[model samples]
Target: MIVSLIVIVVIGIWLMSMYNGLITLRNNVANALRQIDVQLKRRHDLIPNLVSAVKGEMKFEQETLEKVVQARAAAMSVKPGNMKDLAAKEGELTAALGRLMMLKESYPSLKANEEVNKLMEELTHTENQIGFSRQFYNDICTKFNTKQQVFPTNIFASMLGFKPEELWELPADSPERENVKVDLSF
Candidate 1:
């Protein structure tokens, strides 16, 4: 009877350890995702400033400016925790912003505007940060998902209700996936 009690206690301890590990992994994934959101917030905030700064210079580029605004609106509307929708919206915004930025080369006034230059620099930096955060988020998500699928933990993970996270991948046909066609015929 004593042996049975000891075995039960050991199993209980092991189960608790597994549960804690899963929680830690889950939290790490959440933290990484939040980092992406932080960077994205910076980008979203800068878009209007950049758009306004260049609006007067890119007089013929109203379509591009409109696209950026619409994309930003769509991106900002996505609820947190919906990574799939968020990624898609963010990807669209990125493409629109990229197209807008490239037009700076076409418009000499935009290139000369100090405000536009500063905002563009800040937006570039924020994009780099967002890229790093996304990579980290994906890495953490992979570890969390792998942990729940391996060894003895596998048997208990689903029983404990853990789910795999969605990774931020650009859709195969996304404009961001295409090679940027730069025109230098100014």
Candidate 2:
């Protein structure tokens, strides 16, 4: 009887620990996603100011500006997923933004404007931060998913109803982002 009681107690403790670990992992994923949203919001806010600043100088690039706006709209509508859809939209938006930046290069006055320069700088910094935050989120999701699928943890995960998280990713076919690389030769 005493041995049975001890076994039960041990099992209870183990289950509790597993549950707590899963909760922490899930929370980390959520927090990381929240961080991305925060950075994305900042990026979105900067877009209009950027567009407005360059509009006058970039008179002939209306098509490029429209693409940027459309891409932003698409990105704004993206939802969470571990698969291709989410990543593709993100890639598209990033590519469009890349195009917009390249267009800016042709207009020296726009590039030289104080407000445009500052906003561009902020947008660049925010994009870097968003990328870092996304990596962190994916890492957390990987850890959680691995734990949920592993042997002992898998049993506990199943018992506790833990499931894998969808990864937050950029669009899969964003050729634009791929082409936006700087020429580092200099």
Candidate 3:
């Protein structure tokens, strides 16, 4: 009876440990996503400054500017916790930004503007940071997902209401995936 009692206690402790580990992974994923959100917000805030700086110079490219503004608005409208929608909107914004940047080839004066150049640089840096944060979030999510799908933990995970997270992925044919061709013939 004593041996049976010890076995039961050991199993209980193991189960608790698994549950705690899953919770930590879940929290890590949330933290990572928050990092992405911060970077994205920075990018969104920088867009207006960038648009204002380039507006006067790129008068003929009004459509391009409009697209960028629209995309930014769409991206900002997505609610937090909706990663799938966020990713889709973000991809659209990226494509719009790409088109806006490409206009540099047609408008040499805009590209040469120091303020515009600085804002573009800041936006690029923020984009990279967002990418890294998304990667970290996906990594943690994968670990958590695997833990929840595997043997003994799988049994308890469902009981505890753990669900897999959606990864931030661009669609296969998204223009955002294409290389941005910059014309440096200035």
lDDT of 1 by residue, 1-186 (tens): 999999999999999999999999999998898899999999999888888888877889899999999999999999988877888889989999898878777677777878888898998899889999999999999999999989999999999999988888987777778799866685
| lDDT of candidate 2 over 15-124, digit per residue (tens) | 88888989999999888888877887788888888888888888899998998888888777777543365567666777778778776877889877899989888878
Candidate 3 per-residue C-alpha lDDT over 67-163 given as tens digits, one digit per residue, 9 for 90 to 100: 9999999999998778778888888898898788777657777677787878888978987898888888888889889999999788889889899
Q: Evaluate model 1: give its TM-score.
A: 0.88
lDDT of each: 0.89, 0.81, 0.86
lDDT of 3 at 6: 100
Candidate 1, lDDT over the whole model: 0.89
Off by over 4 Å in 1: 1-9, 183-186
Query: Best candidate per lDDT, number?
Result: 1
- Write down the RMSD of all candidates, one decimal each: 2.2, 2.9, 2.4
What TM-score, computed on C-alpha atoms, does each candidate reach? 0.88, 0.85, 0.88
Per-candidate count of clashing residue pairs (backbone under 3 Å): 0, 5, 0
Displacement of the residue 40 alpha carbon in candidate 3, Å: 1.3
